[model samples]
Every structure is written in C-alpha cells, then in structure tokens.
Target: MTPPNPQDALRAAAAHVSRRRFFTVTGAAAALAFSVGLPQAHADEPADPGTVRQEPFTLGVASGDPAPDGVVLWTRLAPAAFEPDGGMPPAPFLVDWEVAHDEGFHRVVRRGRELAHPEFHHTVHVEVDGLAPGRPYYYRFRLGPWISPVGRTSTAPPQHARNSAMRFGVVACQNYPGGYYTAFKHLANEDLDAVFHLGDWIYEGAVSATGGSRAYPAGTLPAVFNHETVTLEDYRLRYALYRSDADLRAAQAAHPWILTWDDHEVENNYAGAISQDNLPPDEFLVRRAAAYRAYWENQPLRRPQRPRGADLRLYRRLHYGTLAQFDVLDGRQYRSDQAFGGAWARPGGDADDPARAMLGERQEHWLADGWRDSRARWNIVPQQVVLAERRSEPTEAYTVSMDAWDGYTAARTRFLDAAEAAGVENLVVLTGDVHVHYAMDVKRDYADPGAPAVASEIVATSISSGGNGAERPASYDRLTKANPHLRFYDGRRGYVTVALDREQCRADFRVVPYITTEGAPVATAASYAIEAGRPGLHRV
Candidate 1:
C-alpha cells in the first residue's frame, strides 16, 4: 500500500515525542507487508510480546552513512519472547518513515516505506534520498500508531557547492563493560556536520573469553548464556542493550554517521574464516552472517547491507564540498585468518604469498581506485586501527593483529604505493579501535626515518573501551617516543572533531572525562593541522 499516511506517521511520531523519549522503538504484528515468504520457524510465533506491553516499539532509531542527498536510518523490531540467540519467533513489521524540516513536523519533506521482516531479523534500514545538501534536517519513523523519537540529520554538500566547510566527529570502540557512552551525550550536543564511527561499533557476545567483562553502567552486557552470538537472537540482544543507552540515543539523534566494522564488531581479530582467541572455524560463517546482517540492520546503511549471507559491504565513500572525500573501509571481512594469535603475531610466515590478502582483491581495488579518482582537496581513509608502521626496540612486546594493517603489511604498502602512483595529495588515515589516539606522519616505509612522509594518520581513541584516560601511559608515551614519525599520542576516552578550511584541516582531539556516568564534559586534549598540499601532518 501507499506509505502510512504522512499525517498518520507524524501523529504516531508526535505521540512518541510527547513521551519525552528520544528513541521510541515500536513492534507490532502487521509490521511487514505480505508476500516476503518468512521461514516457518519464524511464522509460527507471537508478535510484539515485549515485557512493556504499553510500548509497541523495541530499541530506538539511528541514522548513518549520510550523503548530500541521502542517509541510512535504522531500528530493530524485536519479536515477542525474543531470546538472546536467534530461535525467537519471526517478526514482520512495515516500518514507515518521515523527514521534516523542523523537529516539530512542520515541513514534511520525505516519506518512505521499509519492511522489517524475518528475512533480515526484523531490523529496519531505510536510506532516504533527495534531501537538501549541506543543511540540517530532522527525521523519525512510524508503525500502525506508534512513532519513533525525532532524530536530526544533514547531507554532504552537493557537487556545485563551493567553499563549504564541514565538521565531523570521529570515534570508535564504545565497550559497555569498559565504560559508559557518556561521551556520546557531548558528541550529540556538540554541533557537527556528521559523525564517523570508524569501527568497533559492537563487541561480540563472547566477552568472557576475550579477556573482557560484562558489567556496564545500565545493565549487564547482553549475552547468550549458552553460547556466543552465533544466531540472530544473540545479535538482537546485543544491539538492544547498546541502543538502550541514553547517551548513545542522543548521539544517534545529533548527526548522520559513517560507520565501518572493526574486529570486535564480530570478534576480536577475526577475518574471513578464522577468529582470534580460539574459535571454531565451523561456528564462524553462520556467526558472521548473523553479526553482519544484524549490524547492517541496526545501522542506517544503504541497500548494500541487504545481506547476501554473511557478507555486508560496509565500505562506502562520502564527498564533502570539494574539500574532502571519505573512504570508509571494512577491516575484518575479506581479510585472511589471523596469521599470528595474540601478542605474538606471525604474518611473516608466508607473508608474501599472493594468496594471503587482508582486504581481499575487490576492496583493495576499490580503495586504489578511490585514491586515483578522488577530486577533493583532501582524501580521508576512515578505517580501523593505526596505519603507522611498527618500529621495534625490544623494550616490550609489540604484536600486530594479523587482522590489522600489520598482518596485511604487503596490502597496506600497496595501498600507499597506489596513492603515490595516483598522486593523491593530502592523504590522511582516520583510524580507531586501538583505544589510544595519535597523530603521525605516514611514511611509505616506516622503517626509514629518511623516507619522505607521504601522508598523515590521525588515530582516534575509544569513545569508552580502554582503561582510565591515564591508565595506558606506556602505550601512548612509549609509542610516540620510540617512533619518530609519531608526533602525538594520548590514551583518552573521547572523540575527534575535524574542521576543514581552505587553509588547513585541523583535527582537534576532543576527549570526554568519562562515559560511565551522565553529563561528562568534553575538552580538546590537543590539535593537529595539515596545511593544504603539505602531504604530511604537523602539530598546531
């Protein structure tokens, strides 16, 4: 049928705003349109049986991967008796959407239809397009009568727009047990053009085995009592608990997000077929499919996430006002299995074997092409982990996750090599998941001090996954000191705000005191700037 009436959508949405709820998740039976053959297992189940009968929705709403004319909106419609790991009854819901120029639904600009069904675990992803470029916009969702909380979004500048400066918040790894998302509150409040979730969007279900804990501020980390998240239900619970955080909701409301998956989004140091920390190969593909699909569903991504088994394309590109281009890469999928486990990685064993690839052949080509074709003044590769080469001095153990650039040394070298070939000026690597921040000159060969700096790497610390802000003194201090190319380093729980101007790109490392509590204030720990045509980063 036609999109649930725009007025109906607003009434449903307005009702949610009245509740003073920033994220309103509603679930109902006729959620999905007929004809999307749901599995029998899912069909014979009750719909919308959540504990809180008064509320029809489940979880909240979020948006990501924004462009000048489009952005991805997301939500999960949990079925009745939803358990942690799959096997819950199938849920089918018709997710209605609305976009307004004002938060009060004054000017309804776009309306759309999305199907939340069993085929995709009841999670809704609607990528709305044709929005005004370089301007802020408000949005929300609707069910039969229930509406989601109002969220805000903005698009990238259209191609013809000129001299338009843009600001974005960069971050990753917000583990529940490590701390709270207190930083999210400030990130939401801080005016920004968009948000870049570099990676570690969600930790897997097997925290105990990962040498991590489950005690977060609000509630226990969602877990599968019997096994890790090998099924849809396991992944569902994981997102449910994560979205429940008020800080996270506020951040989701503030701006559109550009996201990618780090190892922990599925499993620590996991790759195509192998998982770090000793996981069975057989348990992986199915597990990955669930994780990938769940991740795609819960986030505001485009049609790319319409899962084809376990593989979802998280790699995407966004352009901003001819000033910058962002290539958000996926680090975990399409990578070789962990070459070495834990602190002692073994990538050197058959490291040059062409068969061994980190980004696989396709992603490698895609990145290479992006470097060659980008016309923006700056080219940003927003991915996970650090890009600076590891320099060893024998003072301590320094092992690279074979799943990281370190494991795929040859591949990363190729990427840099292509940049050189493409003459891609102002190449910058935007990284996350190390739980430590750094600003370093990216040399094609980290082993050579005399080697020219071809680009810069700005590594963002955790939103709140690592230890106390000062806990990892050695990790930050020692790394910067030992590596001459490393200009700045800090272990803080916060995010980065990068402001671009015609003169320079200034990255202000903003750290929140803590996320384990509400009302954490944000401050700039340091700032670094890369002058136009400089080719390398410099401390400001």
Candidate 2:
C-alpha cells in the first residue's frame, strides 16, 4: 500500500467523524483488529449494564502543545487501567471538559461536551482556544457528578512579543520497572513554562521481577504475550500502566508537555519500518501501526498529529515570542537503516555516505529553512539521541552507537554547517535517550581538530531507566578527557532544567539521590551557562 499524503490522510480521518453523533468511535469489529486472539477473561467487558458507578478519571488529566491562543486537553476514562479495554463498555459515553483562568474554576473560559468511545479507550482530547497568551490556565473533565483533578497549563507568548523568556524541564527515558518516579515529583514543583519530553515514554519490553532495584508489582502484566508490545492493546496497556503513576500524573497536571518519541515507544532501537530483530518489513509495519495509533490515542497531541496507518505528522515548530523558536523534530520516522547492522563501529565510509540521511531529505530542508527564517533569540532543537561526537574508547579511531547522530556524520555536519552558514548563532540542542547527563559543544566539524564550536547541546539523564546510577561513572573521566568539546558527564537518575533569555541560557543538572524508593530529594549536581553569541558552555 502506498503511503497517504498528509492532507489526504487528514481528510480521510475527518470523514469518519460525525460531530452530530458526538465523534463516533471505530466500531467493535474494527477494534478487533487490535484485540484478535486475546483471552476473553482479559477483555474489557461491556459497561456494567448500568450507569458508571466508579470514577472514570483514575488515569488523571493532561494538556499539551500550547499555542498563543490555546492548548490541547487530554484524559482517558480508565477505571481499570490494567484491563484490555480500560474497563469501559463498548458504547460511547458523554464526557464534559472545561478550561478556566483559575484552579477554583470560578471564572469559566471554555467549556464543552465530547463523547468518549470505547474503541479509542474512552479518551477525550479537547482543543480549547480563544484565551490570553503567555499566561496560566486551569482545566478539568467531568462525567455527571464525577470531576477530574484540575490540571494547570499555559499558552506560549505572543509570537511577536519583544521581551520574553522561557523555562522548560527536559526529561525522557522513564521505564516503569526500572525504579520509582521520585524525580518527577520534584519536576512537578518546578517553575516551568512547559515540559520537553524527548520520547521513551514507556518501554515496550518487559522486565523480570528480580532485575533492578525495584521489583515489578503483581498484576501489572497482562495474561497474553507480555514480553514485548506487538499489538495495539498491548501498547495501550503499557501506556495505561505508566500513566497510573502519581508522580508522572502530577508532572503532567502541573505543566503543558511537548512530547516526542524514541525507540522504546515501539521497540528497542528499531528504525522506521525495520525492527532490530530483523522482522520482515510488512510484519514490522503492522506492529508499528499499532504502536503509533496507541501513542496518538494516549498523548495530548492535536488533530494534525493523528496517526494514519504507520505515519504521523509529529514534527512541527513552536514559538516563544521573540525569545526562542522550538523546532521539535522526529528523528525516527524518516531515516535510513542503521549502518554496520546497528552496532558500534568506526565512524567513516558508509557512516559518512551523504545518502545515509537521518532526518530524511524533506525534514533536513525544513530545518534548514527554519534556520534561515528564524527571528527568535534562540533556535532550540528538542530531539532524541545526542548530537555530539562520542567515542567508546579514548584511543580507538572510531565512534559508538550507530543508532545515534554519530552514525550519520555527513548529515550531522550538513545540519551544523547550514546553521553556521545561515548565521544562526545561539543554537541549543536538547537531547535524551542515552540515560546519562552530557553537556557538550557542537563543533562545526567533529572530524576537524581545530574546528570552532557553533552550538551547545544539553543531554538529559533518564528519569528512572537505569535505576539509581552512581554519581560518577568511568565514562565521565574517559569520554570528557578524550573529547574536549564534552564539558560535563555524569551517570545519575534525574532530569535537566533549562532557563533561556535574550542574554544567556542556564541549564541546571538536577539529580535525584535515589529512585529505588519514593521521596528522594533532588539537587543540582552541576550548573552551566551559554552567553549570547557564545557556542561553548561555561561551568558556573
């Protein structure tokens, strides 16, 4: 089957909806595509044959993609989250949502009713608009007398505002069974404009009970194939389990999120329609479609982000007044297969092949155009995988991780060269997916020993992926010494906080003492800053 053009896909999706019938969901027969061969006992039984007796908002509420005029509100009715169907009936139910200027909801701004269909797991996504820009708003969902916990969100500054600053909490790689989410509790209390989630939202693989510092709780796994998520229901259940965490939900309720996915959102280290396990393209595409749709249904994305088959238009731009221009990227969707069969090797030959594109030709051109047209003081690229040059051995004449940008050296060089040629200074790259903290300078050409730095990259550690990591890993000493552009490195479990303005950008490397148990204190292990027009980082 040929891939549908974006506009045609959107039109086809819209054609399925009938607003008069309250956005009718896909029928049960259609859902069977995701539920075939499942055990009857694990299925979500038709509603209790009566009214909803239990609260449907057990999974919590969230909002994202804030525009100057509005934001997108999200919530799924999952009274029994671990169940196959989120314990909802096969019928469509009415859900009411409202957005207000205050937490108390005394002053109502936007209020409306939308139907939740079991086919989509009774999830509701409301796009609330006509509000003031660069300010906070509170929202909630209701089903008759049951009301959801009020969630707080904010809009971006007006695109042309002359004086503005932006604060964002960058995080990624939260494996449920890795450890507890103590870092998220601290993140929820931060004074942030928005949260940049660079993927790995949920690990598609399963963990043994005796694997990490924490053990998998009983009943968390489904009765069917729970080793890896290969079906739509499997992916949905994984998301439901992750979202059931209180700390994660608190972080979602506290701020608007800008989310993008990495490998584990589907399968570990899988690229495009190719699986690392070497599954056939046609078979892998089916699994990809399931994971993609499940991802779309669970997150607070907008209409344009809706998945059609295995393709979704998730890459876009967001502006923060004149302070920053966010070119959120999707590196996985459009890319060539990893070189050297997706393993670490010397970085030359095929790795330097100009045809081995990472962001594909179209996205590369799009980013280059953004660099030329950008007017914001800072051009920030929030993406997965580190963009700096990282080598496994200090003496080896090579790089590691063909899955990272190092494997696409030509594309990386081209991207940086375009930014430099366009006279775009103040380029900041926020990265995740390495499960460690790294502050590096983006050299014009990593292969050139005398090349000048043109940008700064801040790579965040995983929230709880590797559990409670040591304060200092051996790689910290070796990699930092081997690469002078790499200013800092630490192996810890936490996130990165960034504050940007016209004059400078400060990044606080916040680390949690422990993720094995709850209530761990978070502290800034290190701090660094980049002054205006400067390309390297200064430890301050």
Candidate 3:
C-alpha cells in the first residue's frame, strides 16, 4: 500500500481542528491569558462532553526546562495513546494543575487551569512561575475524577548565587523495539537535580508484532506501530507507544528533564533539512514538521520551544546558580551535511573545508558569546554528538565518523579556539549517541601528543538501544589505542551521573547488565573526575 503524504495528513489534521483552539496568543496577550488562568470547567462540562473514557493520563505527567523562577509541567489527555487522535474528541479539554511544597499536597503553592486542545494532540504545557528558587516542588494534574501521578521538579538557584554542589543524570538513545527501558527504571531512582536526555528518544522504524527484543505478547502493541513514521499522526502515535512505557514515565516524573534531539527522533543521521534517504528538501521538511510538532506536544517544554512549521530553536543556555551553566545544543538541526557520503570515512575534501559547520554560523557565534559572558564555575555542554576526535584505525591514516565533530575539523578547531579565547575555566561536555560510555580529554590539538587538554567529555551509553552490550566491544581496544585522549570506554546499556562541586566534577558511568530481559541490576562500570582548573579525565 502506498503511504499517506505527510503534508496531506498535516493539512487534514489542521482542517479538523477548531481555529479558536489552534490560535496561540503571544506578548502581553499570552501573559494576561496565563496570568488570569484558562477558563475552568469540571470534567462533566468539558468542551467536548462525553468524549473521554478510561483514564486520560495514560501517558503520565512530566516536568522540564527548569529555571530559577519556574518549570514547565506537561500532560496529554490520551485515553487511547496509539490512536490517530489519541482517542480524544476534536475539541479542547480543561486540565487543572497544582504545585505543592510536599508530595502529599497539604501545602499548595501554585494552582492554575489550562486547555488541552486537540490541535496540539490534547497536550498541555503549563509554565508555572512565582515560586521560590532552588527548592523542590511536587506537582500533579486533575481532569475531573482522574488525577495524574505526582511529579517532582525543582527550580534552579538564583543566577548569581554561589551554589556548593549540583548533580544531574545524562541519558540517550532509547530505541523501543531494540530492548526494554530497564535503564530508565534505574534512573528513576537516582537522586538528580535534573536529567539531560541527549536525544534518540524514539526510533523512526517499524516494530515487530512481538515488540522485537522485548518479546511482548503477539498482540500487545497496536498494529499502527508496525510501519515507519511519516505523518504527524504517525509521529504522534509513535510517541504514545514509547511514552506508554512505565519505566520511562517514572523517570520523567522523578526529575525535571532538559532535552535535545539527535537523530532518530525524526530520521537517522539527518543534518539540517537533509534526510538520510536524500528525499527532496520540501518533502523532507513536511515530515520534519510533523516530527517536530509531535515532539513539542509530548515534551515538557516552554512556549519558545514550540515549532513554527519545520523550524524549532532548541539551542539555549540554563544556569544552575553560579555553579554550572548548561548549554543544551541541537546538533542535528543546524549541522552541515556529513562529508564524503557520511559515516565511517577517511577525513579529507569537504571534511577539511574551513567553512564546514557543525553548530551552524549563528550558533557558533552564540556559543562563543555565551562562553565570554558566562560567570559560572563550570561550563557544561550537553550536546548530541562526540566532540573529541576518535580514530577507528590505529594508524597515521585513520577513518572517523563523518556524522560527528571529526567530520568538521576546522569547525572543531574553531570551537576549541573560542573556548581558549573565552578563558573558560572548567569545560565539561556531556554527550550521547555512540551507545557506549567514554571518558575522553578534549584536547586543543588531537595531533599533538603533548598538547594540554582543554576540556573533559563524558559520553553516556544508551538507555537501551544496543541491547545487552559487552564490557568491551570488538572495537574497544583498537579505538582506545588509536585515540590516546580517551581515558576509559565501556560498552554497556545505562546512564551517567555527574556531580559537580567547587573543586571538581565527577562522572559515574552506571550500566545495567542486560536489557533484553526484565529486572536487571545496575552497577557502576567506571568513575572519572576532572579538577576545576584541569581539563583531562582522571580515573576516580
């Protein structure tokens, strides 16, 4: 059967949605609307009455993009998550939310109401403000008789305040069909200030009836997920399938998340508007628009993160008092196309071109300016790809991944140069995508063996993507030998926890033994630390 056109699907969804529900307010109008709160209605008096059945919060609740003053709380009214319309009516539904100082909600701090419009897949993102900074808060949603699971979130410390310590979890690359979300289950229990998810939240491929390695019952997942995602509805349903995982939901509820997409959220190894299959830019953009919109709908992001067609400005900076500054980057969105036909190629030609950009020209400037303006103790870069150079062949002539920073040599040099010029004291880059844990020294010059390390990079392994990985994969020895800057490597499935203080930053690589089965135990594969003034990784 021929697949439905993405543009047509988007247009059809838009046509069915009410204009009043679709239109969004901005500036003073938005401020007034949110400040006064949305029109409140009981579940019985819903705009589309009698449309909801079962529990509407099957996908669960989440919080994210924390600030000193506020955090965004998110939930979607999806009684049937896998359905084309998420089993909701074509009208808006009222969702009530409250923030409390305690999980039991004996002391309420903030309360408001928002409309969950079908135009946005019945999703609501409530940016709750007017709260004390650097304190934990519990929140939940109320839709008539049903109440969402309580979520824990916290605001960052005041901008100039001197924070003594901060901790966060780094995770990425969770492909649903490949394995279970056992890593997320473990991550849910970790004590973290926030979680940085570096993308590949969902794969864009088809799923088997038995749910691949998960070995679910033959008819467990809906048949709708057996095909690759293409349309807005397809992407929306895909997110629903992933979000249906209880472990993933638990982690999201446990801590506020700061997320950025790599590839596989839309398509694998996509660069800018270019797709891996090399489809026409216009056609690819339509699919991208669908993916971006669905991503925003499902995520706990603020209004500015919303997509305008295929474009979404995802790169931004967040401060944790004066202790750390997180520059969450969107590597897949603005990068130049991979050189020499992409992936595992010997560097030359376009790879050496001085004009090749990884973060785009505008973002490069923005990053440099941010570095110059930053006053935080540690400059933390939460990005999608590996920043340090990795040589696959242990020889003078080595091959590297064209899809990574190695593909843009001049751009990498410029980045290091900018950091040096900005006088960045402690630079720590947190990365995900390689599906293996790696602690490497970000050097000013990879060719110079004696060059001083300029930064430290901690690459977290996948949450589940590569199945049950070995302690040392086949390429482990060769890659580590070829790249002297690499301090440690582990091919395991799990997340990483980084703790930062006045003197040093330490990263603990936490790994689960297996993900193909349930109830796997987690262990610390390795731990590394970087001193405040030092850049290289030291085994701790």
**Best candidate according to lDDT:** 3
Kindly report which residue stretches of model 2 are placed more than 4 angstroms away from their true locations once superposed.
1-50, 208-212, 216-225, 447-450
lDDT of 1 at 498: 91
**Per-model root-mean-square deviation over C-alphas:** 12.2, 7.2, 7.8
Best-performing candidate as measured by TM-score: 3
Candidate 1 structure quality by residue, lDDT tens digits, 112-227 = 87766666666677778888787778888876566777888887788556645778889889875566787788888888988888887777645442224334434343234224
Q: For each candidate, what TM-score against the reference?
A: 0.83, 0.90, 0.91
Candidate 1: residue 124 Cα off by (Å): 2.2
What C-alpha lDDT do the candidate models reach, one value each? 0.69, 0.83, 0.86
- Model 1 lDDT on a 0 to 1 scale: 0.69
Report the candidate with higher TM-score, 1 versus 2. Answer: 2
Off by over 4 Å in 3: 1-51
- For residue 392, what is the lDDT in candidate 2? 78
What stretches of model 1 exceed 4 Å from their correct place? Answer: 1-53, 78-91, 205-227, 277-282, 345-355, 392-401, 515-518
Global CA lDDT of candidate 3, please? 0.86
